[model samples]
Target: MNTPEPAYTPINCDYYDRLEAWATMRTVCLLKFYDEEGKEHEVSAVIKDLYVLNKAEYLLADNGLVIRLDRLIAVNNIPVPQSC
Candidate 1:
């Protein structure tokens, strides 16, 4: 059975803007986030795209990883606020 996705916690607008800027500039960033099972992961890749799917926002990385915005812990050492 497919597991239901966790409720998306909207990120701060300023952080979202930063992500957009990075994607536009193709900047390589260190991304830290939690996976479906709540495992922490880190990767360095350029942001390729940002899109919404099924009402959840996600970012695609140059390395072909798609991460939900709510799952992100930090980008480039900048911590993502827990509250929206």
Candidate 2:
């Protein structure tokens, strides 16, 4: 007899939508995410673009950082510094 594997659900779109909104509006946000080894990390940057390919998603930041959407834990609004 063969055994069946468990069903897996994909991550929700709320996180992606919120992030996209922030990116489109050029809003700065502090992001929290867990690394592959379950280590938590945080960073502050302005969202520059959102990308979706197949079932994968990513966020591009102005600082040339690429972040996976599924790894995101939380997003906090931040104020952007003004130029003199």
Candidate 3:
């Protein structure tokens, strides 16, 4: 049986803006986030795009990783706030 995806929590507006900026500038960043199994992972990649899918927001990395906005832990050492 397939497990349902966790409910999407909206991230901070400022962080969202930063992600957009990074995507626009093609700035490589260290992205820290949790996976479906709640395992933490990190990657250094440029943000390629930000888009919405099925009422959830996501960021695409140049390395071909797509991370849900709410799963992000940090971007370049700046922590993602728990509250939006």
Candidate 4:
């Protein structure tokens, strides 16, 4: 019998923060966050703004709607953030 090692992928919080900042500046961008069950979700929006941290989850805003970051998985590439 052979044993396998566990793989790992580091998550970059700074990258996420940059993406969030870009989105807030009206820069078109996507966001991916983890959900309660550790599910990945891709959300598309201008990433309006960073919702202040709530009691349980990292708050996010998209197209005027607020959602928890944990509920996201992967954000597809989007045009660079730009001022409207």
Instruction: After the best TM-score superposition of candidate 2, give how far the Cα of residue 35 lies from its true spot, in angstroms.
Output: 2.5
In candidate 3, clashing pairs total 0
**Could you tell me the TM-score of candidate 2?**
0.68
Q: How many residue pairs clash in each candidate at the backbone level? A: 0, 0, 0, 8
Sort all candidates by TM-score, best to worst.
Answer: 3, 1, 2, 4
- Best candidate per lDDT, number? 1
Stretches of candidate 4 off by over 4 Å are 1-11, 31-43, 57-59, 77-84
Which residue segments of model 2 deviate by more than 4 Å?
1-10, 77-84
lDDT of 3 at 75: 96
List clashing residue pairs in candidate 2. none
The lDDT, on a scale of 0 to 1, for candidate 2 is 0.68
* Global CA lDDT computed for model 4: 0.51
Residue-level lDDT for 84 in candidate 3? 57
Report, for every candidate in turn, its global Cα lDDT versus the true structure: 0.93, 0.68, 0.92, 0.51
Residue pairs with backbone atoms closer than 3 Å in model 3 (clashes): none
Better of 2 and 3 by lDDT: 3
Residue-level lDDT of model 4, residues 1-84, one tens digit each, is 545422323235665566566776776656665544556566666766554442423444555655554344455653223221
Candidate 2 C-alpha lDDT tens digits along 13-81: 655566778888898889776655569888899999987765566778899977666666777933222
My TM-score estimates for the predictions, one after another, are: 0.93, 0.68, 0.95, 0.46
